[model samples]
Target: MDALQGFGELGLGSRLKRISEHLMKEGQLIYDHFEIDFDPYLFPVFKLISQKDGITNTEIFNAVGLTQPAVTQSIHKLTKKGLIELIDDDSDKRRKIIHLSPKGKTLLKQLQPIWKSIDSVIKSFGMETSSSLISHLNSFEHKLKTHSFSKSVIKSLGNRHHSIQISTFQNSEAEKTAFYDLNEEWLRTFFYVEPFDEEVLSNPDKYIIDKGGHIFFTKLNGEIVGTVALMPLPKQNTFELTKMAVSPKHRGQKIGQQLMQYCLDFAKNLGLPNLILYSSRKLENAIYIYRKYGFVEIPVEPDCHYKRCDIKMEIVF
Candidate 1:
């Protein structure tokens, strides 16, 4: 009944292209469901740009194994979408180097978890042995027909979210140590720990708890994998959502978002006037998440608490 199946090995290239297109279409649907502005066709080029940090058009063309014109067009599309920017090379003013824009970095954070889910689902399909390329293709196509790829990915993400648990600060020493450890892990990874950070993290009870503030931790399968603090600010009826960190191994599982949502809900229930947060502009993905949660950028004072605080944001209840 199917002419392509009848053609067999002779149509291998065409069949592969057809399957690629199908997967891409499903990828677009997945992005749509998540409200992400992206084109699945540009994923190869986009992914390359993200990994390379900075690259040239020629390099992208070679790396992606695409025609020069195709690479150029993909670059144009990414630029138009405000996901990337081209800057003049310092060595050669005529040469242009590509880098991810702030929006692109934000999109990367949103996409990485989804990418993992996609990889997991596709890898599952390839687990069984197949006799030939044609046999594998046939089985893959059949599985696609029977299963909704986009739905499966969404379900996978949902299951991950459901498995996580949020808990308030407890008196356990291990829990207290997690607060310091998780915060220290990220600080050491991205920025060095300041004396102020050390003082506060080392004594959360004296600084945060006794001062009418709250701390929250995220547990994944009984492991404390993330922590956040809602510390009372100098301003009346306000709190600063600070010292938030997710364990390195659990970074991509939306643990940060969960802690953020819990803090917002906790603040709301207490009838707080507003919640403020200080952050570095260098943390673009984190800033994007703040904005996503309805936090608006506010001016940072000349004497802000942390030296690394370049930006301040707040959300009113």
Candidate 2:
């Protein structure tokens, strides 16, 4: 039998259908309230233009996976509505730069309150529930992108319950030392290049104390099994997710996804608008997580210390 029939046999089809309908209605309500002609295509286009000003129409089409004419049509409508404007590129006369018009900015400003209302509704449900939904969405997105792993792996991972925990690291020596010792081998084996420094390992308290970065660990018992670090970026409203390492024995357990969810929630709680990360294709699992979390690959900057890293991912909140 097909998937739908199987789900019906399991008595879950009706529930699943209800969920789908609820989500569809909720999405439509959001778009309607914003007074913007909402389509699946428009959200990404708006996100791209809002974040990367002066983007060309061709670039927007490519980035958002839309046909040139379709994008142009949408742009024309938005322009007529006074939400966007096309300007001639000084460097390349052949290309026209797309930007949010003053009216677009005003709409965005107006929509901010609506977005916050939606967010508040979600938050009212509680942090754990919101975090769980975000985690599931991120996982689904990652699976679609990488096309890695087999059906068996997916099934096994799906059966497990993943959770995130956030806490401030106590400025205590023993706790810090213990975390370092437990994670040392996992870090060494997974991140052979640019392994956690001995100094940092020897003094976790000092590292967090002096550096002011939050240390988040993932535990599957009394033992710490995975970790991710959020360090301050040079500029305000941004942070770097670093030192994300999961124990080899727990590789397929979806521990990495949980850790990433924790980091994302941490950033969101701080009201930061963006989070940046550096990773290598060597760790396919990690790259998949980054992409699953709405991160897009960007040009790598020079003077990056990790020689193995050739990819950089950034997510704008």
Candidate 3:
């Protein structure tokens, strides 16, 4: 393993790329087995275009996390294959937007079940492993942006990494205030708060704790920075993770990752087999974290609590 993966995270560019290439080969085989004319390395670009039709090339680079040249080459391939088309923007003739051609749309429609199978198999991987991979990747990227990885390694080469403390709500006024403040800050930023949000945020003691649920908070430097709730379902052994948020000042600092880790551990400790969540597509960052922890999007419930929820996902352990 040392020969295969040297120096751990401090030196892992080649190792990560090696693992990625190996996985990409497996993914290509999956597509080939289904007789789909797709390249696994280019799938992210295609999928992003499908999800965000008419999105610009720059947007694809950001959303797909690929180099501009890589996205450009894939787009060229798709266009040449007649699976996608680049159209000049009506508002800005200089800019071209990417969207699926009729051929791509119909072909994807036909491959829906194949995609479902791949998604299911990936979700079958260990929840903790998948979650940690996504969490660490996000943390590395965040750290890299704020301070280069090489610099960070020199600064804290031998010391333990910064960690957050998790605490269960104690019904203190200050804790309740933090809970409401944190959740409200995020809700207002992305979506309007609904009546149900008010009902739960205002009285977690009644709606959550007293009703077989637990709310956990993440504290950093003696301040409550994030909160999450695990509400037991009416049915047995089921739960929902709701009202999760971290301070904007502390956002992208891996506070949410700690909150989620606590929730996942607590759920398993209590013999829960699955954890569900409801969110919107607009909350792409949140969705990525959820999926990292093995949450797969399920059909939306007809009577979900939040009006803003367009996507429902769950991790079935």
Candidate 4:
């Protein structure tokens, strides 16, 4: 039992502080997982600045309800970290305007989805009915303990990414070209397109679709942004997950991972026994994601069908 809970109303302030610290630590872990260099404690000030391009220190202090000196110190730290810049106010030379630096803007782009996930998870914790402040805190803490806050946030992000619709491969001319072009884009980037790759990509319907296989694509606002396919293997009731690619413009949005999940679900619905994939170890991020999705590495045959493949992985349903 927490001693702070024993103090009841008398320890309200300490209780709130303890909760705040716990949340801040979790927030920091989330940022670190995304490889973002940000302090969760500085969020209020930074978020306020992000809202208003040319905000003033006085305005930040007033809006966040922080002491003037604390707000000033936050602005100082942000400036020192190169996340925000202080510029002379055009109307008043004595006053300074705060703006996010270019690096900060880039970071914000990376952080928006993460913030959405955090907001979603926190809002979910508020759904329980509680009679009093302390009771509410207890319920919230219980929920946090029951479900990992960080994992919840990450799962929320996956759901957000799924908002981009994934559809089965339609035999439309445009979609056919998309399937070919998307695969070619990645192949040319990481490895040369061998004759086998050209023939397979050029004729997905013949090589994959007609051979008792399936293809899936993710569309963003009616534009096909990503795709993956499952080709039937010679072994009965097994398929090779292959040709996964996301448009370069949409690479960072987890479209690839979303496609992987969609294919897994499709395979499960079909009652397939297992899914196999051949990938190169040089693609570290893709390899890691495959492993995360429960794909175990297997020995690659010396005469692997695809010359570019150095690693093979499989997941049993």
Off by over 4 Å in 1: 1-61, 66-152, 156-158, 235-237
Show the colliding residue pairs in model 3.
none
How big is the positional error of residue 78 in model 4, measured in Å on the Cα after superposition? Answer: 28
Task: Give the lDDT of residue 228 in candidate 1.
Answer: 94
The TM-score, computed over Cα atoms with residue i paired to residue i, of candidate 2 is: 0.46
Q: In candidate 3, which residue ranges exceed 4 Å CA deviation?
A: 1-163, 235-237
Tens-place lDDT per residue, model 4, 1-317, is: 87887777888999888878988999987865553557888899999999996999888988999998889888887886667978998899999999998656766787888898899899998789889888888888788778889888876776434458889877999989999999887677556798888998999989899998998999987889999999888754589999898776566576777788889998999998899999987665577778889999989877788987999999998
Q: How big is the positional error of residue 89 in model 4, measured in Å on the Cα after superposition?
A: 45
Candidate 1 lDDT over residue span 239-298, tens digit each: 899999987656656778889999999989998878999998867557777898999999
lDDT of each: 0.86, 0.61, 0.72, 0.83
Residue range 1-317, candidate 2, lDDT tens digits: 33433343354555446444544455454543222334433555676787885898888888888788888887876676556788999998888899997646645654544455545543433333324443443343333235322232233224433443435566556456556665566545444434445555666556544666788777665556667678765644467787666554444445667778888887899888888887777555456557767999988888775666799889998
The lowest-lDDT stretch of 10 consecutive residues in candidate 4 is 154-163
> Per model, how many backbone clashes are there?
0, 0, 0, 0
Candidate with maximal lDDT: 1
Evaluate model 4: give its TM-score: 0.53
- lDDT of candidate 2 at residue 263, scale 0 to 100: 84
Using all chains and alpha carbons, the TM-scores for the candidates as numbered come to: 0.62, 0.46, 0.52, 0.53
RMSD of 4: 9.7
